[model samples]
Target: MMRNFHRWVGLVLSLVLFVAALSGTALSVVNVLEAGRAIRPASTQTVADLAARVQVAHPGLEQIRRAPSGQVSAWWFDGGQPGSAVVDPATGRDFSSADPDPVRRWFTEVHRSFFLGDSGRIVAASGAFAMLLLAVSGTILAVRRLGGWKRWIARLRGPLAGRLHTEIARVAVVGLVLSAVTALWMSAETFEILSIDEASIGAAPSPSGRTGFPLREMEALRALPASSLRELSFPAADDPQDVYVLKTDRGVGYVDQGSGKLLGWQGLGFWQRVSETVYMLHTAQGAPVLGIFLGAMALGAAVLSATGVLVWLAGWRNRPRIPANAPAARADTVVMVGSENGSTWGFAATLASALRSAGHRVHVAPMSAFHPSRYPHAQRYLILAATYGDGDAPSSAKGFLGRLGELRVPPSAPVAVLGFGDRGFPSFCGYAHDVDAQIRAIGWR
Candidate 1:
């Protein structure tokens, strides 16, 4: 049942998941490029030093912001026109113009909201949730196929599509799960369903109506190192009532322009820190190497989705359908099947048809529905079982062993157990072996 659920969900959501993965991969690449081009300042420098240097270079400086990557940017009004640039903290020189990349921005928007704003975000979140489900189900299926968790990395023998899907999923599951879970977390925060403390700087102190003190001498700003600075908005040049607003990794604060005294501060709450960490990990904005690794995983996810669909289509095309199958209670020969992907059912259908052609009453049903007492006139029983992960029962056979144990009366009919599975698996036909053993223990002939 779980195997079928995983397959159908992947089939239905493949396109959306593909688009999301592709866009995410592209965004990660863009982040890497942007990180490479950013101008990083020395760790020992202070926000005060950067501000002082920037003020000298651009007297109209209005704001200085630090990216998660530790890159500084400054915005200012030049000749009554607003401008912004990536800045060098040491010299306060503009290294690059703040021109957004259209392609990256477009992908970002599509990735977050699919260009549909709020509705798109919900869609994106759904995709993420689907991906998470696929990862979990796929892992369970893989473990069953391999015979056990201990042999999870064992070699696999199967059709090309199945093998490829399993291989890629084994390596990429961690990253895919991480991405999906983080995406959901961020989406919850976006919708205001998860309340995270917003950084707050208390009311600004009343300006003294005097020119602000030297940036180098501002005690509050001097205490904040460049490494900790998130953003620093300077007081407006024309407004005496305005005060500098400082945001750092620890919290937010307001600094009096005239006295340079720290007016109000609010430390970041635990949830706020958690949210920021999740954002950084999800976006890989602070770590280029991690970004590249996740991008490769996203690419792997795309491949996994394609291969999974192919495998499902192949299984569906090959599964057999029986016509005019005999009723379970009236048949003399019962063919019970335990199939994960419908393959064992195909074998059962063929066997049942062959038996019926020989003038024997044959019925085919899932192992879970097996009832020896129901086949009162049965002469023989044929069991076709497929082993899933870790020698565990497939969805169709989940409760069969327990049902067999509960039988009040053992049948005297002859029984034959047939196991179907790849030889490369550590516990080949494990469930079939269990079925055969259980039948004997129950006193079946």
Candidate 2:
């Protein structure tokens, strides 16, 4: 019963989860293409040369700064006159001011939070929670179908919906968890409680006065590789007091404007680094394989959602509708049920559709409402409930433990129990095992 309650709630949340996963997949590759196109000539260009080139163009410029994508910023006579342009690595052509598609930004907003801000954050977090539930429910379903968790690893039967759901679930569970955890982490960071902010960094001062013409020297700029740059800040002015601020994947530091001399470096805090990595992993930046993985997970999420609905709808359409005057719960050939949330008198009423149709007057009721008297005319008792968290019982079965102890019945009834669970959990269907043992000890004769 406790398990059943968890199941229905999980089912409803699967819809939102579907959206989150699909959007994540789309985002994984979208920006990758954009990043690839934002190319520049020699990603390793020096602050001095880049400064001179853009400075020659923007005479009023005090300095030149470069973005991660090699976009150059000419900070004019004053920083306020900053002019930006993307520099093509092959041509040194300016492309910095290029605007990415607004549609992509919009899509990002929708994917991240449905554009609701804090509430959107909750939505994303809630979606992660729902995904966790789905993975769990999928595992439970697989274990029960295989007769036991021990059996599930080897001899599981291959029912289409159940089999497909579990197999893909087993393979995709890791990816799903990766995605969910990162997404949740991002959501947490968005809420500010996680505090992923990096500390403020000030570059070391350059040699004061008499700036050398480092811009004309090719060898100095060629010494550094393009990949090392995260972003580069050129000297602030001709006074040579300003150094090159280079933010790299490893740390933030300054470079001597004339000699390319490396300066004081500071690394990012753990939380800041972790947050940055998580965002990249969640979006598959720099690694196409991870992006492909995200896409596959999205595909699986959709498949699981579809099959779940198909499995439920199929059973629903076929389930018998028993009349109120039907024979004793024990005498009826079979029992059937139609449910929404599984919160109704499910365990104490009727267990499920197929079990009720198999020529058995099933004793079905919400787990909390179950009474031994309800099965007075039955010989066999069957319980089909969905398992919730790490094998916890659903809400409908909350009273199962207490009621099982309270009810006294003839010691001749034998029961068969079936449970449903997601395949993403370690303890799938654990609660069902607990329930079955209790039923056996009761000696329902």
Candidate 3:
């Protein structure tokens, strides 16, 4: 029963999942293209070098925004950066890519939040929930077929997509779940659900008796690399009170607006900094090294979804009818069947054909299709049921017990239950026993 439910639920979400994966993989390669666009060959200058350059150009300014790539910008305003520059990759010379460019901001917003704000948050949360269901549902079905966790990932006999589905699912389950949960957490955080203390958000600068320093150090700045800098937020104003904000993946720091002296600093919490790290890894953001591998797996996923749907639809469309090809009361054979994937139906039909020449009434029907009226002339009855996960009945047999209660069968008729299954499954022959008990309960004992 659970197996069929999982499969059907997955069918509904598979299309959405395929689309999301494709778009996400595309967005990951943005960095390579952006670097190509810069035309300067993507150079990285140091903090010391940028500080020296900015100090010389904006002597009156209290703060300078130094890019990891050696591009410099000055900030002394409440709303935004005062000015900016970029380094030419070809010449190792300074140029300008100016801050607050609408293009960059627009792309960033779209990629991060899809520009939908609250609506986007809800949609993302829904996606995460859907993904969680996908992982769990896949896991439940896989484990049932393979029997136990010991051999869950072992080789199984099935079509190409079915085989790949199990194997890829084994390897991808962890990453998939992590991505989903992280997405959920991010959605919650986006709406300010996390408790935030105003003190930690921002604080006023401490009193510094020494307002300015004459000489600034360049060694540290010169050694900095563009790859290390995540973002650089400029100072608020020209007032000596303002400080330059230097943000790295590890922490944040303030430097003297005038002298470039390092000042206050705060280390971001471990998990807080980890947000970007996992997001990049999960989405493949700006990382092309894994491009081929991710692309291949994504294609495999698409194939898996498409084939799964086809297999399911074909089964549903060609399901076995209630009555088998047999005349009334004359034949001495009967076949009772239970199946989730309908693989058992083929076996039942084949069995009926072999017994035809022997002059037996071979009845083939789902467990739910069982009724006293169908076996009017049966001398012997055989129950063929396939056990589902953890010794559970197949979907076709879930209600068979209740139906047996509603209808009483003739007494003392010879009856036998035969369960078909692969030994690899732990629940081998399990549910067929339950069906036998149901039959015995109705005076077949």
Question: Which is the leading candidate under TM-score?
Answer: 1
Q: Model 3: how far is 380 from its true place, Å?
A: 5.1
| lDDT, model 2 | 0.59
Q: Which should have the higher TM-score, number 1 or number 2?
A: 1
Q: Report, for every candidate in turn, its global Cα lDDT versus the true structure.
A: 0.86, 0.59, 0.59
Local distance difference test, candidate 1: 0.86
Model 2 spans with C-alpha error above 4 angstroms: 1-6, 35-85, 95-97, 147-159, 203-207, 210-212, 216-223, 238-240, 256-260, 327-445
Worst 10 residues of 2 by lDDT: 332-341
Per-residue CA lDDT of candidate 2, range 308-356, in tens? 6655555455333434424445453222121223322244244444555
Off by over 4 Å in 1: 323-334, 345-379, 396-398, 402-406, 409-413
Model 3 ranges with Cα > 4 A deviation: 29-45, 51-117, 195-227, 233-239, 274-281, 284-304, 320-335, 346-365, 369-382, 387-392, 399-412, 416-445
lDDT of 3 by residue, 1-445 (tens): 5566667666876665565455444443444444344432235655454444545555434444433223344433323445444544333334665555565456545534457777755755675577677778878777766766887767675445556667777776665676567667666667777533211225536524344443335222444654455444445343667655667656676656555555666777766656666555555534555444454444444555676676676667546564457753454676777876677877777777777656666766677776666666777777778876557777777787787778644534588888866555555677887777777777774
Q: How close is each model in CA RMSD to the real structure?
A: 3.2, 6.8, 6.3
Give the Cα error of residue 95 in candidate 1, in Å: 3.2
Encode model 1's per-residue lDDT on 270-342: one tens digit a residue.
8998998899878999799999998999999889888888988877776677788888779899888897667
Candidate 3, number of clashes: 16
